[model samples]
Target: MEPKNNEEEWGKTAWEFLTQVRTQSPLIQCITNFVSMDLMANTLLSAGASPAMLHSLPEIPHFTPRADALLINLGTLSPSWLPSFNSAAELCHSLGTPWVLDPVAVSASPFRFNACLELLRFKPAVIRGNASEIIALSMPQHSTTDSTKGADSTHESTDAVEAAKLLAQRTGAIVAVTGATDIVTDGNQVVGARNGVALMQKITATGCSVTALIAAFVAVDKSHALDATVSALAVFGVAGELGMKEAKGPASLRMHLIDALYGLDEAALKSHVNITSLC
Candidate 1:
């Protein structure tokens, strides 16, 4: 399938998902690191999705299948979190609930690097990362540098497209590479969502929060994971673009971004969105 066809199909499906979010608020179980907790939870709420931070082994197993989606972020990996992560992933798989993965700093530590590979065994529905993280996740040998020390990407979004495609092919997951311009793929197709501000990188926790948002969309609309990922990216990026214009800096921009997301509608998307379809 070509990128244009994928974009067209995803576009319609995304709108369907937006309607679903408005009607049925899905509960999202997030076993993410502590760094992104506030931004992620608030973003999910603004987008009409419920979010819970459930990381304990006992709690995660009980909640994983009941929630609409399970989102795991390996930002601050600890040995204690491993059992919970694995058990929740297994429950999601057994219950047929979709899940999203964010390999935050897989390149830095041997523990996180191997842990990410282990997470792949669960077959994530969507994978979200920046350039280096995506590159490292796809081919660890080629990208030895870690991207978790800072939220900013050292590589352009375009540079990671191939890596995203490769990872998607290997895992059968929708891959989202976010940078100056976000590129999302499912091995055979690509959709570029070009509507964010450079200020997005300056803000802390944006990428991790975006990952959680993607999971929320995917949980509500599992039939089209690519569309769910793209919609989440596009909507969040568009909000950033709009929010930066009126805000003073990263601090104010973060608050305004949430307002912008809550303010987003079909009218705003039709005029403000700048995504291009390319295969």
Candidate 2:
């Protein structure tokens, strides 16, 4: 489906998705990293969704089916975490539950690169990552190494737009490449969300948390995965901007960001969101 070209319409769509998430409170099963677990869960809860950070092989079988959506983040991957990650993804595929993949620093390690390729077999509904990660994931060889400084992106978001488009076409999944200007595409349509502050990069797990938030939005509305992703990112961007207003630094911004998300409403979105459909 083509996203609305006008900013006002897109803002309304975003607002509707946010309100739906609050009303539905979808249960999101997130198999995320240890570093981001606390913040990711808090981000979801603040945005009005139930989050479960369960990543055990035995428990996933029972939990995957019950979840409205699933998130797999390969930030702190370990040999032991593989079983649970694979199990949860497999169950999510079988149950036809929408899932989001955050291939954090996939280009930084061979294990993460190989693991991401393996998970692609299950077909994630959305793939969220930084520029370098997306570029690495979309390469034909899947062996082309890109520069990734830890979990930070070495490439700009604009540099990955074509890669993201190609990845979306190949995997049939909505792709989100986040940076200063976040981009979301579903192969056919593309949108850019410019509403965040630079201070957002100072805080850890904000990007990872956004991936989980995308999962929550997808759970509430699967048909418009592209819209859900764009909406979520826009909301995050707006919140980041609002948070910067009163924040003294990264430390304070982190606290204010969650507060902004909890207080986000249609009026704020309509007024603050700067969204544009590229296609």
* lDDT against true structure, model 2: 0.91
Show where candidate 1 strays beyond 4 Å. Answer: 1-13, 140-151
lDDT of 1 at 206: 92
The top-ranked prediction according to TM-score is 2
Worst 10 residues of 2 by lDDT: 139-148
lDDT, candidate 1, at 242: 81
60-165: candidate 2 lDDT, tens digit per residue: 8777899999999999999999888888888888888999999988877777888998899899999999998898999765564467788898899989999999
- Stretches of candidate 2 above 4 Å error? 142-145
lDDT, candidate 2, at 238: 92
lDDT of each: 0.83, 0.91
Tens digits of per-residue lDDT for model 1, 64-156: 778999999998889999998888888888888999999886777677879989888999999999887898889845344445454446678
Specify the highest-lDDT model's number. Answer: 2
Error of 1 at 48 (Å): 0.4
